[model samples]
Target chain A: MPGNPAVPVAGNRFCIVGGASLVGSATAGELLDHGAAEVVLFDNFAFGSDAAIAHLKDHPRLRLVRGDVMRMANLLRATEGMAGVLQLAAYMTLSMDRDPWGGLDVNIRGVQNALEACRANKVQKVVFASSNAVYGYGPGVSGDLVEGTPFHSVGAPPAAILYGASKIIGEQLCRDAFRKWGQDYVILRYSTVYGERQHYRAANALYIIETYDAVRRGEAPKVFGDGSETKHFVYVGDLARANRMAFESQATDVAVNTSGPAPITTLELVRLVTELAGGGPEPIFVGNEPGKVRLTSGGAFRIAHEEAFRAIGWTPEVDMKEGLRRLIAWRESNEGRAAA
Target chain B: MPGNPAVPVAGNRFCIVGGASLVGSATAGELLDHGAAEVVLFDNFAFGSDAAIAHLKDHPRLRLVRGDVMRMANLLRATEGMAGVLQLAAYMTLSMDRDPWGGLDVNIRGVQNALEACRANKVQKVVFASSNAVYGYGPGVSGDLVEGTPFHSVGAPPAAILYGASKIIGEQLCRDAFRKWGQDYVILRYSTVYGERQHYRAANALYIIETYDAVRRGEAPKVFGDGSETKHFVYVGDLARANRMAFESQATDVAVNTSGPAPITTLELVRLVTELAGGGPEPIFVGNEPGKVRLTSGGAFRIAHEEAFRAIGWTPEVDMKEGLRRLIAWRESNEGRAAA
Candidate 1:
């Protein structure tokens, strides 16, 4: 992390709003790994995990504050004495689509609570985990959905999803927070992230992990849409590193593309998962249905990881194949077996 | 009002989520005027007026639900029998800027409550009163802010005001609600609206009325800015009509502008008010300060009026001059002697 020394060091007090979740926990763990003196887990536990808390319970520096993001007083208590915050608390993917009202409450109101806390605490810098979903399935590469892409929430000529709408709102919240408070924030619009501890039980990720498990069981991995639809999946560890990089960087108004180098089609992913799992199952292709196609993808999730790389000297350490291998192996291990 | 009769009429039981303020009360009044079978007013009365409630207290088909938009249960109860909803409850310009914490709670959380209420109540259509402030002052025709202008919140580059930030969040909530529930919504981004029954004591309109009174008392109306910067002031009456048009037309996935023909610079406005008041004070020009240049002239409002005109054959009956005249006359006849 050879960057401006002005960046707050990890040993300094830090807060993770909604820190009991996979992304927030990962970010907190990364901070602890990099020598943070204090890592406060500020979470309402709404979609949060007790296992995550139990995992970090032994860590002397990590403290968990059971709190809701809709309540400012709770967030304030959680964020007190923290120098910086990593805001990863949001309703994403199928969660919002299935229940938009809940999504609005968690995503929009939750973010607002964190922002208000940030303002009250005068926390120095915040790294907001936005999503590439803000850019709905629109045209081509356009330099890998850079920070300045005109967000067309209305996907193409026809269909759009609630997930995209929620993510767009999330980005706007970040922008507004930054604007109103001059609070330094790093917005990382992550591509689809998959790794151990990922909330695989969620509808969208259920498919991903279910596919992996089925392949392990020598069954065909079920894909809803045609295999041609592509996605950019970055390992969760790499995303965790990106969070650390953002905290250690001084770039203002920074929004980096946190994605893998290559965009792989769903078919390719299925085959790769099978190969990584050591010859378990064949890849199965479902027909091109509207709902499935809309969910899978019509546009590629290619992002230029250069901004993040250059700013934080962060790079993807694990390629998809190796990452998938580790994921499968972990899934077969004790904890993995329990989760399965 | 003539358009496609195929467009469905708003459901019989209509509710205005914040139907006690300027926009909400005005919208409710218009809905009643346009033949809504039943109109329910759901407001917490944080900024609402007892006088406004008293005016509508005796209406045959009107009902009042005294509740806050932040309280989901309250909103749920209020929305129980409503078919369509006009969500107009929000912490407005002055309140948001002064009390940012309260602003986030009321604006963002309140919106979430309304969204949940609408979804739970199975409301047919939700007409949301968004603001043009979502687009901060950009380089264009002062009144040329369009629906598609990249809405970089003023907080982005030049710094967004808390009011602007709140409205941006409100707009996102509306978008999310529409996407999540497949709820039909019409987002009307109104410009500065001035008309009858506007809380003249409210911070925003109070300043305007105070200035008018000062000028009428032969005192110079002080200009905060250079007076060259302009704002598109739409009459509240016109805005009310626009809301009616939105309900009557049944337009979906649309955010139309509701502004007057063009903009009147502060200097020009002061001059007009002087003339209208009959031998009143001259205008005083303050230097170009940071706060003074705050005005948006995006054309979205003009386009919205045109769209409304096309959809409902609606036109703004009162021009700016006439509207100002009406406001001054009303003020003089009723409150002038007492206040003076």
Candidate 2:
């Protein structure tokens, strides 16, 4: 049923680095579903979920290799004979801010290692997973966050955060690699992606998942900010499809913004999850935020997605309402399986 | 003589990475002449000439260490307790074009290793040896170069040429190190530098020095490119002084052009060398026919060196005519010593 002419026919090998993570796993699934002959998942298990890896274990076309990207030998070995590489292995966002050394080692050095391997292996294309955090809260609407925007994150609040700076540096690495190697590459700057398999301990996606779980358990869903801040919450499945589209598109110089078309306010998202969970409990809004506050909401993050759609002839099939329902259902099924 | 009211009166310690090379050795001498308390020369002798290292071995305040910058342990050991670092150790212009792997490994990875050492050692100032070759031959004026011109370089040139791209990448590395670590760094984008102790076999400087030697031996000097091509030649001593000034400057943002005040036409330069060599031979100007012409001779590679001069009170006292005469004398003396 996933027959699409744009999707490369089966027997074409595709390798997804960091394939055991939320995005990586979904990308792997999409590639296999679209008839890739074989999908090799390369990951070091740093932040990748075991369940995601286990779910794909039974797929005939999927193979898993546990490896770190920092080691060039390992990446080269895994990338040998691969047709294309989707580099998704990277340090966690929170990890970047806390452990800058690890972040640089993994993000910058690791990415270079991957590129070197790809170049050596004669890989046809490389798709890098970048982030919207590189935007660092556009300067009013006029900033309009274009690809060519001279990144002025020098004194920005996010620049002070190591995670955002790593993303910026990663983008620079991609640009340099393109300039130097002329390799067909695409940078997917994903927004706040959330869905099943997201770690409940992580900040962005965990907040929503834990809040819904708490409300269902007859506890209040706690909110950090004034409940007025907003962000674009893209479903992980949709992000995976976007990556697939990018791989299929012939566009060489592409850095598509992958996010939900509709920007959902944090408070509204919480309320919708609570409603979907059958009016479990009221959300306890903790007024006044502590950490960095970037209300990068509304239609601002949607611009790149529009560009992505026009370029690849693709769109997100799952809306927030249905996406949330699917997440809640997955959570319930997992809970039931645990109880049994 | 090297007193600067800008740099505090306390003696300054400097670490010169790859300090055994022509540029590094020259820079070391300049620093010593300007009154640096101590200078440490770090190199693995990868491409550094042994004679250059031996020449400075007797200096009272200078020390030498055999170590590669690619090894983090070696870099850390070499840089420990230094107040300033002058990084000049790199694969030469012709070498980079031949072995790109070695070029990337040494130029990019080697730079990172040095920077990591600098951060660990708490080195106060970093003066990176960059090149104007990064600008690739500009239009109109042969030497009318500026700091803001766009970079252009095709793969390795006639001689395996990773030097240009490596310098460009090196500049990026410095920028990243500054942004991430807040370490003060100055990128010295140098033009064709020549003086005593420089090897006579290298391409650019070799042509000039060989011409001088041939004239001294009563042989005709050959000129390529119609005698119209020009080059900006800074005396090695002046470049060394610039390094000192860069180290002493308090400004964090620093990337300045450093070249001789006068642009030397290839033909006129040969004539001056002929006269300096006691008028042994006239130069034969070959017309502007090109097989592999490095036609960067005319116009202004001269930048606002006044910025550096004001900052550190550095003045190039060695004029080209006197400098060439001195170079010929040094070469003759060295040959005599070798024969003895």
**Highest lDDT against the true fold, candidate:** 2
Q: Where does the lowest 10-residue lDDT sum fall in candidate 1 chain B?
A: B1-10
Candidate lDDT (C-alpha), each: 0.68, 0.69
lDDT for model 1: 0.68
Candidate 1 scores a C-alpha RMSD against the true structure in Å of 5.8
Q: Give TM per candidate.
A: 0.75, 0.64
What tens digits encode model 1's per-residue C-alpha lDDT throughout B263-309? 66667778887888886766787663464223434332233356556
C-alpha DockQ of every model: 0.13, 0.06
DockQ of 1: 0.13
lDDT tens digits, residues B201-239, model 2?
Answer: 356787777787677667889998667566767788888
| Tens digit of per-residue lDDT, candidate 1, span A203-309 | 44455687877876678887655676776778888888888888887675666778876777778888887777777656777774455324444455566677777
Per-chain TM-score, chain A, candidate 1: 0.89
